[model samples]
Structures are given as C-alpha cells and as structure tokens.
Target: MLPSDCPISPLPRSAMLYCEIYAEVKPGLFSSEAKSQSSDRTMDLGLAEDHFSRPVDSFVASDIEQLKQAIEECKRLILELPEHSEKQKDTVVKLIHLRLKLQELKDPEEDEPNLRILLEHRFSKEKSKSVKQTCDKCSAIIWGLIQTWYTCTGCYYRCHSKCMNLITKPCVRSKVSHQSEYELNICPETGLDKQDYRCAECRTPVSLRGVPSEARQCDYTGQYYCSSCHWNDTGIIPARVIHNWEFEPRKVCRSSMRYLTLMISRPVLKLREINPLLFNFVEELVEIRKLRQDILLMKPYFITCKEAMEARLLLQLQDRQHFVENDDMYSLQDLIDISSGRLSCSLTEIHTTFAKHIKLDCERCQAKGFVCELCKEGDVLFPFDSHTSVCHDCSAVFHRDCYYDNSTTCPRCTRMTERKQDLPDEQDVGS
Candidate 1:
C-alpha cells in the first residue's frame, strides 16, 4: 500500500537495526497506511528509511486484513455457538439476523464493542439454558401473549384457583353456598373495587343482583360480622364465656343463659321504662316471670302428680302457647267430700295429696307404682301383680313388695314414683 519513492537516511548502524526490528515486530503499524509509516520513520529515521517503510507497509496491509477477518469470523461463531449444530442451520441464520439487528442498534458516537459483546453473551446464555417463560405461582407454561392471570393483588402472586378457600375453611355460608348467584365486583371488607376478587361469604364472584352486600342481622351482639352470619340468628357463642359458672352465675343457678329477642307488636312504655336489672329486658317480662315462677313453684306438683298439673313455661314468647291446654272438669261430689284447693298448702302437702290419690295394686306390697325405667323416678302405675309392674313415667319394671321398702328413689334421677296410674279425669278428683 505504501509507495517506495521517499529518500533514505544514513543512520547509525544500531538505529538502522532497531528500525528494521520494529518494522518486523509490529506489522500492524505499517499495514494501515504508507503516510503513517512515512511520518513515523521521518521522525525516527532519514528520508531513505521513510522510502523503505512505505514499501514494507504495503506488504503488511494485506496480511493484517486477512487476520482481522479471521478474528471477526471467530467472534461470530463464538457468539452463535449454542445454535451451531448442523441440524440447527435455520436457528443459526435466525441468530445471525438477530445479531445484525443488534449491530444496527449500536451507539452512534462511541465504539459499540461492549454493546455487541453484551448482546452476544446474553443470547448465548439464554439459548444454553433453554430458558422459557413460566408462571412462578403454578409453574405453568407462559407465552408473551398472556397479559392477565388470576394473581393475588396484595402479593402479586398468580394462582389457578380463583378463591383461596380451596385450602382454608371458608365462612360457614360460603361452605353452604359455594356458588353465589350474586357476583361481587368489590372487596366487601375494604369496600374497594376488585374485578377478580371473591366474596368472603360465598367464595364466589359477588353479583349485584341476587345477594345483599350487607347482612340484615349479625350473630355477634357487639362485633362486626362478615356477610355470612349477619342474617343467621343462632350464632355459636364461646362456650367458655357462655357456659362457665364462675364467669356467669346465672347459667349455673338457672339452666342456660341464652338471650332471646322478642318483638312485641305494641311496645308499652311501662314495659320499656323498667330497668332491665330489676326485670328482664324482654317486652313481656312480667308475664314471663310469673309463668317461670309458677312452673318452678309447682315443680313438686309435676314430680308428684302423674299428670303434669305444672305448666311448661318457656322463656321465649314463641314457645308460650306450646303446652297450654283447657282446664279439666271436676266431680262436684269429690269437691264437697274433700276440701277443694286444700292440696295447695305447702309444696310437701301437695306432694302428699297427689301421692295418696295414687291407686296402689296392694297397700302392703305397693307393686303398682309409676317409675322411670332408666331412673326409676316418676309416678304412674297399675296393679299388674307383684312380679312385674310398668313404670308410669318411664319403662321401669318393679315388684309391689319392693316399691315401699325402697325409701331412696333411683340413684341416678332421685325421682319417686306413686304406685298408681293417675286417671286422666282424676285431675279434679280432689279439687
């Protein structure tokens, strides 16, 4: 490439030897252009040396270009080594096309050697690992086209099941009603719009049409409730708090501490004005208290009499008329012979009157006595002989002789039986 027409300089023998060695050692310097070689030699040597460097530069230029092309080819193959198989010729071509596109995207101002190297390294690493897109939640295959999936908005975790209740125990109503007709578009708890969210109640999409967003009632008295238990009146209370005698003395003194809500059509000021501490908070407290007192007061009657002279009083208004009945007629003669209402003395007096009224199989044997088969407690039996007698209250079989001697009733229930079936019409016999 360089011309051999410049003048040669007479230099020191050592300098001449050094110039020739530099020319031979570093061929790239001379291969680029003759002007460059001549200028360098002019500073380092005379006019004769410049002329010599020009010719030498031409010879090196061709060799250097060949070496440069070889290196570039080697770099290309290294970058495309992952898809270099003969069977993957199409892949190789595709990679080459991609490389060309990357080259086009190089920095215009700066040399893009680093950019090209980075692209080549990344492409090779991806191909070697056969990296494909997949969902982290389900590990399902993913393509670039799928933009939206069922993902937890809170954690950004994608999942297949639309609702989380598949593992957890959902709200009771949600378990009962798996697919709610009403699809909700918002989170009920937060009152925020959620297209993919589910109702905590039904575990299904909430609809605006069928299901109500808020519950009409709630199980918890003083707490916020989910939509599920709002309408359900009977909610499970903590047995520890409700049933513990130490915490609640009413439960042990009474049987239970269930608070029943009673709605009266006509709310009276007298009923409403009374402090619930003095009386209960219910509208019909006066009547309810009277009924309960009567029932408990007449428990001796219920225990002694074969027929339940005791009215079954319930705390709930709904159950008030459950056991109500018309009064039975009494014979006028029996009323005159025995002092009417004399049995209503002490509770023990009533018990004795009801016991004496019982018709025993034999006065001595006392075989025909009513007794619970399970507990041997109760009165109501007939004279069927000494061997076997049916219990009036329960299916207890007892002998006449054994009835009187057994002072203590059945250990289980402690209920005593009167040895006679109290006839149905006999309620007013001693009236």
Candidate 2:
C-alpha cells in the first residue's frame, strides 16, 4: 500500500525490499493518505520556527537579559553536579564561554579602562614541576595539554585565559605605599583553626583530609592558602634577608610572592635599626657601611670644589644616591649585590674617584682637609682616614697614636678651657 508515485520505488530489487519493510513498520507514512497529514504538520512547524527566528542585527536589551538568565541557569546546573567530576568540568567550561560572550555584548571594547594595574601576562604550556597549578581565580585544575593560561610576570598571579578578563585583584606592585613595611617574623604560622580552616586569600574551605584540600603555608605572611592561591612559588623573605642575611628561596603564596617582588628593589629596610649585629657578621655589610660613611664625608668637598662640580663627581653615585644620603637603610637588591661583591667593587671605584679629587686634584678641597693637632704634621688628615681620630668635645682631628698617648683629650679643648679660666669671672666683673 505504497503510493504509486512514491520516491521509495527506485526499481532496484534491494531498494524495493527496504521500502516494503518500512511500509509495514509505519503502515501509513509513505502512503498517499498520510501525505496530506504530514504536509499540514510540516507547515505548522515552519510557522513556529518563523515566529522565533530574528535577524542577528535585531538583538536588543531583551536578548542580553535572556543571556543573563541563561548564565544563571548554567551556574545552578554546575552547582548541582558532583564536585571534580568530568560533567561538572564541562559545565564550568560552558559557563565561562557564556560569560565571555555576555561581556563582549555588554562592553564591545577589548580593553577595559577601569583596570587598576596593567599586568604583562605571560602564558606557558608547561606544567609546574613542584606544585599542581590551579587557576588563581576559578580554583580549577590548569590542564596544560588542553587549556592555555596566563601567569603575571610582576606578581606571579596565575589564571585561565577566560578568567583573566574577570580578575579584579590589583597587582601587588601597584600599591607601593603598603609595601614599605615587611613582616619581620620568620614563618609565624597562625593555626589553621584560627582561620576557620579556610584559605586566607579566597576563603575557600580547606582541610587536612585529602590532596585537593591540602593547605599550603606562606613563609612570608605565615598564612595558609589553597593550591590555587599558592602554587609552591618560592621567594626570599625580607625578614630573613634583614635579620639572618639568608637569601635562600622559600615557599610563599602568590600574594607574598608579588609583594616580595615589589619590595626587592625598594630601599625601605632600615638594616641598622632592625639588626645592628648583622654588620658584625656580614663582612660585605661592614665594608659597605664604612664606604658609605667615607662617601658622606667626601660629599661636602665635591660640592664646594669648582673642578669637581664641572666634572660631575656626584654623577657616579646617581644610581646609589641613598649611599650618600643614608648610611643604614638597605634594599634587598643591595644586600644581594653586597653578597656577590658587585656593590663593594662599584663603591670602591666611586670612593677612589672621590678620594682622588679631595686629596690631590682640587686645591680648594685639599685646603678643607684637617692637619693633625697632636703631631702638628703638615700632612692633611681627613675624618675618614684610618690613622685619624676625632675628638668628641672639640671636633678636632689627630693621629690615632698621638690622641691615645695624650689620654684621649683634645689639645684645642684644653686651650679653650685654660683661656676661659684666665679671663676675669663674669660675677667679679659685674661687682
């Protein structure tokens, strides 16, 4: 009971056999009687499709509203799925894509103007060798083989490409004011229970139960973070650098890593005030301190001398102006340079240049130099000279051996006291 003009009748024996079986299974769909019914249903479906379809350019506020609702629905579905399951992962990926599309429709501008700090995000395909890296924003596993992600060069903030645009956290280097001080304590870990067993950065509930819930301690801040907030990144802690002079790298959270990186070049550490004994142990520190003191003493001569000014004698210390201005403060980079002997070598060169100008080249500078009072030697003696000693009372300089032999008393102070005693007393003159 196939229609006589039915396309199923191809005249081939194999085609006829297949049509006969289809006709028996359906009984009416291929017959002439059912053609009219099928035509009516097709027309109804086409009308419904036409009612829903619109031009792409016709998108309005209502479409955006619909997208928002769809995104919320997707989020709900994701929450209902089992955590860490493949189905949940797929839903999260879909949700991120939908969010990206919504953002494009809302702003259209590729670059946002309200960003606090622009980060140079460098992406890498290789996984971290030490820790299993997770997205800092989403707390999701960064599947290096399948997903592309970015790590900030300044702060070491890691996140997925999809999460990068959504990041609202400012780079640690952006807040220079807050980075002036450092936590001086060495790994002063506050117990996890005090933090309510949560990550310090994200407030994610963590535990000591499983690998996924393992909490990592930041050596700088001494706070626990989840794997997402801490990727086992290591940095030299400022406290260790200042107190112990230990430059060995230690594990820190992302925030601490960024903060330490910002503080690396800043000369905010008052090393003398923090650890005065450090100078006694670190030979480079002691030598640098002495050199800085010498530079300070030589600064006035360079300023007054016309020849030294024309030659830009202070220009040699342009990069290290703090060495002339302050004797105690040191930066992390300065400490590293001192340990490597680079700072000492550079300071020695500058010191030699300054000494040459003060003692030999400039006549005016040499005239300012002191002649030893005890020995009465014509040879010039500077306060910075190793064989010279300055009197605390009269600010006069003398040979170290001569000053010690004279009971550490200044000759100028003795003469001034005797002259005052020889003069008539003020009360007797008034009488």
Candidate 3:
C-alpha cells in the first residue's frame, strides 16, 4: 500500500508487517536501518537499546546479576581463608588444658631439692671396711647404679669414687668449705697418682691395652677377701666358736698389739661382733614387731641369762591376756607360777638387775603393737602376720588378728592399684 505522498515504495504489505514486528521486539530503529548498522560492524544498537530499556525478566532472571556478583565474592573469601589463625587458636587451647592439669597435680608442701649440689655435702661421713693394708676407719665406697672406682693411698680398700659427696657450696656444717673440690687429679692423702681399683666382691676384668685409666699393679695377695668375710673370721659370731681352740694362733698374734689395733680400727661389718647376743636380741625385736607371732620361739636362742627371763615374761603376758579376754581369769598364784617356769625366776632376776634399763611396759602394752581399725577408714592394710596391717599411706595401723578381716585401698591418699582380672578357665593353685 503506497501512499501518493510517499515516493514509490517497493515494499510489500508482508514486508511492512515484518518491519513492525522487528521494531516491537528490538525497537528504536527500522529493520533497514538496523540491518545497515549490524552489517557495518557496529552491532545492532537497536537490540542493545531494547535490552536496556525493557523491564528485566522477573521469572527467569530475577536478581541473577547481583547473585552472580555475590557468588564471586564468596569464592574469593573461601580462597583467602585464615587457616594459620585457626590452628594457633587450637594450639593455645591445648596448652591451657595442659597447664591446668599440671597446676592441679602440683604439691606445694613437697620438699624441693637443690638443682645444683655437691657430692661431699650429701655423703659427709666416711664409711669403713676391713682389708689387710686398709685403714678400717677411713675406708668408704659410693653406692649407685653407675659406679666409679678409687684406690685410697692411705688405705688400699678399693671403693666407688663418687662416694666423696663434696661440699663446694656451703651447708650448715661448713667443715669442708676450705677444701678445693676441683683438685681430683692427685691423691689427697698420698702424693702418688690416683688409680682405680675394683672391690674383690664386685670385680670386672677388662683388657689391659685399652684401659681408660692408667694401669695399677697391686702387690696384694691374690687370696683376697671381702669385708663381710673378714668380719666373720674375726669372731663376729661370738662364743659360737671358741677363737683359739677353733683356729690355730700364729706367732704374729700378740694380745696387747691386737687390743691396740682393735681400739684404733673401725669395725666395719662387725655390728654383730660388737655384741653378738645383743645383735640377735635386736633382730628378734624387729621380727616380732613386724610379725606378731607368739614370742616363745625366741627362748632357745637367747645367749644371756637375763634374756631367757625376758622371754618367759613375754609368754606369760600373752597367756594372761588370752585368759582375761576369754573370761577365764587366772589367780595371782597361777600367774606367778606361769612366770616362774625354769626360765621364769631367771627372768625375774634379770629384770630386777636391769629394771632401770627396761621400759615398764612392753610394746604390746602400749597400743603401738596393735592398731585401731577405726583410725584407718577406707584404706588398704597389708598384713605381714596375723596381728599387723600397714597402710601404704599415713602408716595408720591395723591388727588383722584382732580387727577387720578385709582388704581395701588407702583412705588417706585413696591410692589403689588394679590387679590383673581372673579368667574363667584359670585354676586356683593354692586351693
């Protein structure tokens, strides 16, 4: 449809319709103009104008551009995560927990040992031993898991070198403050070069070629003996063997000379020789205290006449205690008769002679021998014998013979050890 005013239009009615549709979809220009712009490489300005001008798609593209920007920001944040800071926070928490546990376990009342200490300060007094060329009074050895050896110039008694607990730092007793602790290369008593020697009791032979220290030649008899053996030979067993009759006397044995030598010598390993009978008596006391057995077994071994009487008195007391506790009280005469067995009168005589030395009451009379179970509540008791139980902590006592018949943990500290559990197929060997 060409108007008369419009110059001759070659377009058909369909082409005009197409142009109108195209302008509606991608507006702002005629189809011919749009095609001319696209062909000229300016892209279709009409299409861009139409896209910007139109209301954005509500259903399919709602806020899609904003969402994409947000997504990109999130990805960047993830890539730049602070991992080292998180790990440091975890480490800090763990360290705090460990410190708290350590604080809880700290014992404020414990005795703190000095971090740096000298050897002589710890082992001040010298211990002695007996050897042919050794000075019994000055011989000492250090005892430890790792040992060092030293030969005393004055006394040939071989000993551990570390036993010289030194006092470089002053202690309450400042006797060793003047001595130079660093002067260890030379022998203190003798000017001879210090050499290491091993005790006959604890000997270890090594190759001579690679010896760490200078080799020493001891002209000492190959027939060497330990301090214990020396004590035994010197009549430490007392009258068990009559000295001269049992062993031959040599021409070197001068009684006066022997007495003088003995006076100056420290009798190492001779605690029993000081008084053999006394040694036995102390041993029995320790045993009876540990094992509350009937004291009658000690009667046959007592060397002194006085000791026999004491043993009889002890047995009589036990018998008296048994009768009284069981409501079968003994008459005074019966008590006297029990105390007057062959050893009974002797016992009385001995007690009367040394009544001042003897404590009026025995250990049994004083409640020291028997413990009250009530005092040791909730604690375990390990019994050495029928009458005694020792708590591993606090040392609160119990008499198993007279009191509770059970085992448990210590009440004071609540310390306990879990024993291995019994299995079903295991046989009871004792039963």
Cα RMSDs of all predictions? 32.2, 14.7, 39.0
Task: State the lDDT of candidate 3 residue by residue for 175-223, as single tens digits.
Answer: 2234211111111222122212332322322223424322222111122
Candidate 3 lowest-lDDT run of ten: 237-246
Global CA lDDT of candidate 2, please?
0.69
* Global lDDT of each candidate: 0.29, 0.69, 0.29
Predicted structure with the largest lDDT when compared to the true one? 2
Candidate 3 Cα misplacement greater than 4 A, ranges: 1-267, 270-371, 374-386, 401-405, 412-431
> Which residue runs does candidate 2 get wrong by more than 4 Å?
1-111, 114-176, 209-212, 415-431
| TM-score, cand. 2 | 0.63
Mind sharing the TM-score for model 3? 0.18
Most accurate candidate by TM-score: 2
lDDT winner between candidates 2 and 3: 2
Q: Across residues 5-45, which tens digit of lDDT does each residue of candidate 1 receive?
A: 21222321122323332343234333333122121111111
Residue 106, model 3, lDDT: 33
